[model samples]
Target chain A: MSRAWAVSVAMMVAALPAWAQDVGVVSTEQFESPRSGGIIVRVGGYKPLLDDEKALNGKTPFKDTFGDSSLLLVELELQRYFYQGIGTAGVGVSAGYGEKYAAAKLESGVDAAEQTALKVVPLGLNLFYKFDYAAFEWGIPLVPYGKLGLIYSPWWVTKGTDDEVVDGIPAKGGKWGWGATGGVSFLLDVLQPRFARDFDSGLGINHSYLFAEYTYSDVDNFGKPGFVLSSRRWMFGLALDY
Target chain B: MRLTFAVLLLFASTALGQTAPVVNFAVPGASQGTEIVVSKATCGDTRTVTWSRTGTLPCSSLVFWLSSDSNCSGDPGDGDLVLDSEEVPQNNTTTLSGTLELKMSDALAATPNLSCDTQATNKSYRVCASTKKQDSLLACDDTASGVGTPTIVFTLDPVAPLAPAVPTVTGLDSALSVSVTVPGDTSQMKVQVVELVQSGDDGGTPTAGAEKVSKVQTTDNTVFRMEGLENGKLYGVFAYAIDKAGNQSDPSTLATGEPIPSNGFYAAYREAGGQETGGCGAGGGGLALGAVVAALGFWMMSRRKLS
Candidate 1:
């Protein structure tokens, strides 16, 4: 055949949809993958917004104490998607932990070498609706999602001497109460195709996402009536969806 | 009556003008003079003086004396009289008289004995003799012999203090504890502690160029503590005593001490790699931002679903 015929044949092969092509190591799959039902584990850093907690953190070393303020946070979630009736919507349950610590050595006092820390754990269920336009043949790969959830977060003071108060809250026992959360996730696999590549056979991750979330947890004081142990925080983390 | 008057007058002149009796003092066989180390503290080791008459006149009694003043001009009246031996002169063929022993330690005793007082170290002492006789009326004689003569002069020298015993290391770790025995010879002295730098080859011996760590200001304190020392390093320690006069005693035997290992405090709190958990609690600003983003996401989702 002539060289012109060869070019035409190649063009035909490239034009065909991924499903009608032969199976190989590299397939012509675009953003046609499913958008829900996966396990996600994420770890990030967070800063609390409670006035008392903020005051205590501000006093951490060099601010009035001897050491700096730092907090560690982690989360794990399991989600399921229902695509038949409500477009692409998902429900997920997550458990997470956040700890903020500030240790200081008083220049002079009875409690010269005192350390204080606050730990909070949030466990909740949330509902999310994804805007995946590719399913309607719009040829868009982006999937932006919004979510709202209710959490019963338990918070306690980890390290402090008896009778010491951290940000107006008694740094002793823990309290569990109700709270709320709201956030949005942006699928990065649509922007970076490499994040969706399947390295192994069988069930594999199909998308990578980044999310920013806001949380407000209220752990009312078991003793003080007017005193409330409510706090707010901002968090950003990465998640993988299969 | 006139002859009797002349004889009484002669007797009165002899009694009134009786010349001072001559008294002699000597340390038998001690021609080079008496030498004594105050540290010996033994009375028998002291040099004793023998006295005899050197003039024609005879004294009824003789008294030996020791004084710190070189002149020895004052009798027992001068508080400088450190010792005295009062006795009748002995009758001998060589005109020998009484003997007096000088115990230097007695001069330095905490409680001095009568007739012999404690003598200060590093000083000169003179020995003399005085004679006393009763007058015709049996009253004490006013004129005494050897009032201005010092027969022998002895020097009091301090014995070198005993060196402190090799120190024993007690508490080791960042601080070194060493015990030094105050020299028995002196009670008012300062103890000096020296620390030797490790040459990386300190074979348990003090380095030639050792640096002084501290000086215990009080001799009463035998224990010394050296602080701010490097942990887990070898150091040689030695001590000496310094008297108020700046006399230094021999140094103690060298003692080697090594500090204990310290705990890794900073290492445990260093940065560690991995994901950190604990979500940030959202504030009003964070909530506002989240709501705006959520609204955009919801509107986009609704538009696509309707299409």
Candidate 2:
């Protein structure tokens, strides 16, 4: 009668939704699974490196020239793992909107200030390589990953220098351009819970991850001379994988 | 004895019919240093001359005259009879005192057949009244007003029209539709269109000559149909507004476009945001694509164990 009671309780628990991973003892196999495929969504912020001394507004920082700016980034990606924990290749599309740069006077003694904006919407095809140091019993729970990708981003400068004109047209905004990007992200798998033995064997699902990544992008100016749209920033966000 | 001498002098002045009347005289609408349009619709413009007696002495005859010369010394003859009390009742000192519409033909009647060059040329007028005969007592000529003399100046334009807006050129079959903003009223001004040519020299300094493509007489139409343009050759267009005074305003900004047929590929090229930028070279596109493909292939090969 005790054995039957134990069997019934186990069946009831297995039927429950896997809202969280079990917190059982972690093994190296979790990082090396070969059939993992899922989606990740993240929201973060970035700072523009507009203070390159070679730029037109070199003497002034981006925030000082355009007054109080914030760059907000939102990304959605689909990851297809060929080697699961060993390699994860994905395509991600990200949109970033920089807040209106503060009003600035194009001409001296003019009361009306010119307001400008910057935006970056990039579609990236990236390959991620995750190191499996845990498989060698390194005891380190942090998984380090490297990303390399080609970024096709449509960028814009709503208000540009007053004197800049291309072929009688304002040289402010244009079509999508090409760029290359590379970054490194440290995956914090240490915080993940290991489920009890009853839920150990199943399709992997319902995961929450915390990560921090630093990226550098080198973008072309379409045809604008003496103008560079390259930017670098560190991002921190939460990614839900399923 | 001194009182008797004064009485005799006054009697002699009255007996000789030279008793000059104290009359206040002016040419209405005639202001010192003010310009007047003389040859707009007719040979000369028109105005009125007014006169009044300052004292109780009734002046029998008052005359208004103009002289091409500033000095009123010579009798400018019958042509100078702008008005006379004997004819026009407005010349009378009592009844609103004489007022007559004065034109260049009537005022400068001495030179009745003379053609006036009404281009801001300064002249003069005079008003004289006598209590008796032709001996005038009160007279105000251009010189009588000192440096602020009421001179007769003729002009063609009081003000010039503003310049037209920059033109936009679009290619059509065998011609171009040049669009621009209508400056103002069509009746007051005419449009001047010029074709700009560049020699393609190293300097590339554009020179505009008497190469008039077309003249748009109507101000109501903003689009000028420009023809005789060479296909695929770039042309710069400019516009100007000529006022009634023959004052041509500065030309509008240059609008450069190449003419094309309806079926031409380059016809829509200019409208396709082609200005100020060339496409990424073929080499650039190929290199970027190649790099992406190469990186993806190498990455996939390194992880072939799972595949």
Candidate 3:
């Protein structure tokens, strides 16, 4: 009996908010991150580029990114939220897959280009500010997104190391790649589907969403996928707003 | 870790036991040498029969009734060749026999073979059995002339079994044969060989007859002789048996056998145990034994400087 009462009290406390309803915008023009009150699967791709410093594009293939040879990137991220668009930003961590161009030479802090498959697994923390729509008809309900984070990408298996040579990769598994992003999201409000009832809450209901965001990482000249072997990811994501 | 160990112990306890044969030899009331026997042995579902070898060679072969009856199989004579014989003055040898034999892989290895041989024969070596005898690491003694390249050495002294003062010779059923019969428990006694010597009519003794040409094997408790030698000449005969431990018993009382002399040969060569141990009968033993002392070294250090 005590356990049941304790659970009820805990749930009530969790529902409390630090702030009230929406005052930001009519429609959420923010990137509705993959994060939601409930978990949803997401998979997609993006073309990455350099943005940090001139070094991000120096020995990296970033300059050639606008062309057809930019890069093919794949990514996946999972997240869950607590409140309805007004709580701690549950930054979703993701691992990205892509292709990079390369040459047999150029071994340095950046030049060691690997023209092979490249993959990066990063643990990240995204701080997105959630905003709810005005409790009226046909208004917006989405997360006003803005993310500034860092990912520790260890080029542990970066090519050329297996060719039986001293990779001068002096620093083996290393530091993080700093990144910043922002975007908009569109939600799907009312779909009945099957076996489930659509909430007919007299007010505006939450819906499925679509979003695209721009990113920039300091993966300048890691491999041969391009000059900027590691870069920003332009992604399209689908999410649900509760 | 405890759970893992417990699981392993449980599995091990379930496996059945596999044991071999043990040998313990005895030659009762031995005046000179003792005997040995593999009293208790286990041939469980295996065709393993036990046999003993002489000298320091860990070359005893086990015989089994069927190939599946024993842990080891193949040529009975193909015992492990011992090398690097070492001699540690071991004066005691306690034999265990009954149901199962213990693992002796390390018990009597090449080093022990060498050491024991040295203490027993004053020599160390890697001994190998050959057609003639066995080869050893220790080269032969210079005075050991006429001694072939390979030599055979028994584990005990009194090379010959004790002699019976009033030994009897009977069971003779052939023209040139007679048997050496034991008085008491003949189970442990047997006839091995028949040595024949010829003496001239003169008061002087002559080194008798012809060369001793015997059969490949002398069966258990059975001895045979080829008589019908040059007649009119006196020939002496003796027979004996060897216990499991390679200890030979005393020969029966010498009797007379007169063979019709053919050609100039009037005598027959004596058949006896073939162990030609030099002075003190200590055979020369330690030979080639390599000792490897491998020492691997690794060093790691750490330094911290606060600036």
List lDDT for all candidates, in order. 0.51, 0.47, 0.33
Tell me the tens digit of each residue's lDDT in model 1 across A17-88: 664654545542643354446456666654433323322333222222212343567877666666634346
Q: Per-residue CA lDDT of candidate 1, range B1-307, in tens? A: 9999999888888677654455666557753444332332332256676666553234444555666565543344533544434444522225445666666544334233422224334655566665554456635556654542435775554445667788777434355667777776454444334466555665553463456465555677776767666866667777777543334678787777765522111111111111112222332232333344345434433432210
DockQ versus reference, model 2: 0.02
Span of ten consecutive residues with least summed lDDT in model 2 chain A: A104-113
> Which tens-of-lDDT digit does each residue in B243-301 have in candidate 3?
44344556565565543311100000000111111111112110100000001000000
Ordered from best to worst lDDT, the candidate numbers read 1, 2, 3
Question: Under CAPRI classification, how is model 3 graded?
Answer: incorrect
Label model 2 with its docking quality class.
Answer: incorrect
Looking at candidate 2, what is the lDDT of residue B7? 90
Error of 1 at B139 (Å): 99
Ranking by DockQ: 2, 1, 3
Say which candidate scores most in DockQ: 2
State each model's C-alpha RMSD to the native.
37.0, 27.8, 35.4
* Model 1 misplaced stretches (Cα beyond 4 Å): A1-36, A42-45, A49-70, A83-87, A104-111, A134-142, A160-182, A191-203, A216-229, B1-307
